[model samples]
Target: MEHQWVLLFQDAASVREILSHLIYLSFVLKDSPPLFVKLNVAIILEVLRYAQMHQLFPTFSLQTIVFFSLELVRVTTYEEALGQAINLQKSKLFCSRNTLDDLKNLIATTLGVRQVLGTCKYLGLPSMIGHSKHATFKFVKDRIWNKINSWSSRCLSQAGREVLIKSVLQSIPSYVMSIFLLPGSIINEIEKMLNFFWWGHNSANSRGLHWLSWERLSVPKVFGGMGVKGLKAFNMAMVGKHAWKLVSSLESLITRLLKAKYFPRSDYFGASIGHNPSYVWRSIWSAKDVIRRGFQWSIGTGEHIPVWDHPWISNVARILPSTHHHLEWPSITISDLLITPEKQWNMELINTFFDTVTARNIFNTRCFLW
Candidate 1:
């Protein structure tokens, strides 16, 4: 960072924070040009240089130039300026060509008879921190490049996918249990259900309505129809809780619990805390106070809200335009969604809200169906 000196005394946080922010920006702002080319990059470099002048990071640690280089290019150990650095390339995790396969093989082969879990996982088992055989479901579809690269002819087969999914599900509980403080169990359960939802993507790729919003499938064997929620829709629904955690902070007990445990010192419902929040929180704010879309069976405009007695005013929620973006976070109404009457379906999911209004699982445990 050539401009580190300029930003040194100005304002800066930890290196990880800076790196995370850059990566995040690069992700969300993919449509824009490379962030480094922008003036802010030079400015930050100058600031980092200033920090080095003031002994901000240890002289032996990653210098500003190295910091930029690591993220931007392959930093070679041969550089005389690096004194006697480790050969990061050969010794690093990202350097592996078969990252996924290598990780999976490491987990399945090494931890096969371990009894508890496997190795492909991330951070789950207490013994998995450096065990190299952690049975974790790596987010393979995270980056755009990775996602595209993964779809090539060399990608794993359907049978392999099935095995991977099953293994991932099996390891979920163990991994989640390790994160005892967080609601990892619920998150894990959700992930499995998501796999079930997407297991038959091709069969239901085309919907009676919009192809993206999956038509509900009753869980097969138990329910008359095959039970499958659309993965995309389920993801959105799961993400919705985050928005609620933020916009309706006091309204959600789980968010409060997480905040109490993970961030007791941090504000639970502070609106001014973060510039960008996780998908869950952001989705909550987007859904707002509006009745759940899944609850409204159709474009039943003027259908009264039975609970609040607020008249149902249905229209296509203009969800995309800037006019509708505000409608997402701190949800204003169902109308806030960028929708048309045609896209809105008449599938009701809130028929029995009264049954579980205050109690969890009390409404759906027995013979009743919503």
Candidate 2:
């Protein structure tokens, strides 16, 4: 088993080297968009798939015939497709707590890796997030503390500390923040650490007078306060950037995938946090407010824009027109009001359905057919 594992690792390294060369050659040879790049990568990946399938054919076939024979009629393309081979020495297999011991053993032996309980770190963040979001994300707080502790507050002037705090301390959890909404407790604790460090206190035990609140510090320098980012707001903005992408890039693959899974019936703006949502989905959903506040739908086809639900009209004080009076009218799209082919708004229908103010606003807004 050990000899076979070593051979497998060597083979994996050779395959990686081949892939790197291929990728470099592809980039040098083809000047194309991201979609074409992905297609090129897919073609390269087929090499790995075949290599892995060749190596695992006998064992996989036996396993399929024995263990999963009833569960799955045949192995899926996804199962056969190439992925990064696990390093038996460094990699650990994580399974549900309730997973049977026999199944765990089978997986470990098959994969040549050890089984681990609880959770483990992957690329500085938890590979799996269990309940207790605070506990799961507590590492971010610890990381901030460690970085702050390493610095000497007494040696540096307030100016120096400010730069360090902004550049280093605040940026420690940015990658994590971009993906996950840090628990309020973790954010508060991290802010407290930053507050202490900024006020010339070396440690939590040291006392320093806090002349201004962290909020004031977080305010823009143009607003007569130091330009330090508020973690909570910054996190929201970072995650909201991705949410904004979903709104803007309707044809993107990720947008399509998320739409299919989370909000097949409605658009992204109207998506709900459906049952058993993923942490990624929840984090993105949390920032919907950030996107909503700034997002005004530009008139395109208007087929997707809901007249009652969407914020299409910027001329009015409220982006979304008041709907209390028109509750009786069925839900309608902006396109529904248009006389098609000519793509002109049907003033008769608009005047019949909407109040004078709304009808006027609809007419005032321009819609381009092209």
Candidate 3:
């Protein structure tokens, strides 16, 4: 049921709560009925109302395989409300290769659908991913190349080509990039196509002099180059935004769901790539460097930030305290450094464990409780 809802509002936050539950269905179901094409927020909300009234939802643990039997019934309830049924003939049921044949047949028969082997595409992105990531995301490169070749660059001025590249060509893979981190190779290939387009080469085989490297052109115009976005940097920024959300927007359903599985005990910055991590987790984790460099804990009750380990000090080259200043208070939190009740810095205790420079930095660190 994962759909690209265009002609809708620019942000998805308006319907995010209602759609949050639908994430499970993305893993369970590959295609939506024709009715989905015409759906607006109002129609979607109406459908959810019918679903709730009928008690179609079954409680299940997050990140676990959804019991298809229960979800299929929910789909039936949706069909009844929408007056359109799932086209089982055109639809596909993707399952793990390790799935038992008998169970697969039972579920497929129950839903009246065909079981497809290997990974299937849902809205042009792979529904299931494996180790061969580059192969899995080759569609991104192909899509960009196809679009670039189709456009006739012969008649357009350099300015017109710049607009086309900025507006249409770069946006082609944006949706996919937002979800998954495109491989470096694919990003390079896409940039190569864009570079050619910018310099008047319309086809892959055609040659044009690339006067400035893409990195230079991607710099801001103020820095003596075009303000074209660097694909690698842009992809990281897009994925890092999600990582930041997991920290800032704690109560969000997506945050809760991801936290439950990956970082149950630790925050996003501290979370590890656990054994057999999903592609989604890996993609998000890939931006950990970006998050770590930019992340600064806002000291609230000072409960979360570690005194020695975390980056809490602002406007410094190295936010964490230097290893030269060592202490055995591994269990200490930033709260311990505060004179509680007043919530002011404990200057005497700060000087006891830290060097002169380090002590000054600690005093300068802002505390919200104060």
Candidate 4:
């Protein structure tokens, strides 16, 4: 089994090398990885996981294997990693300054890797430095432009154009939008591309007068608009979905990473925007407000839910009204309102603290006590 595992690692390395080459070619060609290549890479990852689980390298810790295996996978997936690895191996480090002879010696050394400067495509998305939103989304814009330029608007009918815009053109940015809070400029550019495509402009460079504003067009068909999704809202909703997962999918890898890094002491909604957060974290954080706006607690043990602060009551303010200026409510849990022995809400206590209207509303509102 150990010998077979060794052979598997060797095979994985060869497969990784081939994948690295294919990834490089795809990057050079400015195209996404083929479906077959992605499937093979997934298989390699599963095999690596299995090998790790079985303690293939008994001499080394699983952490060590995982660290190196991850690097191998990174090199295979991203051309940038492969280039960086080759550069490191060749001692061709890119820095602000180097000694004259050192530079000469470095130049004289045989080039083993493609030295990527500034930004490069990684898994069909631009991997960039800093927060240059426009530059990062330039590839997406170019892709949309190329796709639009390929098709003739004059040939397609209005209905056909709408179908293509909704189904094909809008989907171009969906993957990127899901991860990044797209800049308004990029969103507008995408909308403009879609508009031009839908309206059937005289030529690729020309545009017909927009019949309705994109804001209006983005409304649901039932709401009297074109039923096209608003890009910004869609992006927010996608990020909010991640936030939902962070709360609900507690055992997920992403949830674990986020909890360790951002909200070690607190929950996801209460997490602070800590200093120097990653772009992904910042994007996720931006959608927290949206999540909070729509979120309502489904009472479990009620230990986590605060009666005064939390939005426990349906169609009511999160905080209850204070009786007097000096009257300070303690951090009251939802469990406090319940009769402990029977595990039921204390109706008399509820009526005592709240106003008649508020008390009536609270009684009417359904709550799960478990």
lDDT of 3 by residue, 21-93 (tens): 4443333453444333234333445444443454433332111112342255457658878889887876888
Give Cα distance to truth, residue 244, candidate 2, Å.
2.0
Each candidate structure's TM-score, on Cα atoms with residue i matched to residue i, is: 0.23, 0.75, 0.74, 0.67
lDDT of candidates 1 onward, in order: 0.36, 0.74, 0.74, 0.67
By lDDT, rank the candidates, best first: 2, 3, 4, 1
User: Which candidate has the highest TM-score of all?
Assistant: 2
Question: lDDT per residue, candidate 1, 93-209, as tens digits?
Answer: 322343344333332332222222323333322322322212232332222123222332225564654444345433433333322212333444344343433353222233323
RMSD of 3: 13.1
lDDT tens readout by residue for model 4, 153-205: 88999888878888988899889878888888988888877777777773546
How much lDDT does candidate 3 score? 0.74
Clashes of each: 53, 0, 0, 1
The TM-score between candidate 4 and the true structure equals: 0.67
**What lDDT score is found at residue 319 in candidate 4?**
42
* Local accuracy of candidate 2 as per-residue lDDT tens digits, 86-181: 346877888877665555665565446778887788778788888989889988889889888888888999999999999999999999998898
TM-score head-to-head 1 vs 2, winner: 2
Could you give the C-alpha RMSD of every candidate to the true structure, in order shown?
Answer: 20.2, 11.2, 13.1, 13.8
For candidate 2, the lDDT comes to: 0.74
Q: Positional deviation of 119 in candidate 2, in angstroms?
A: 1.1
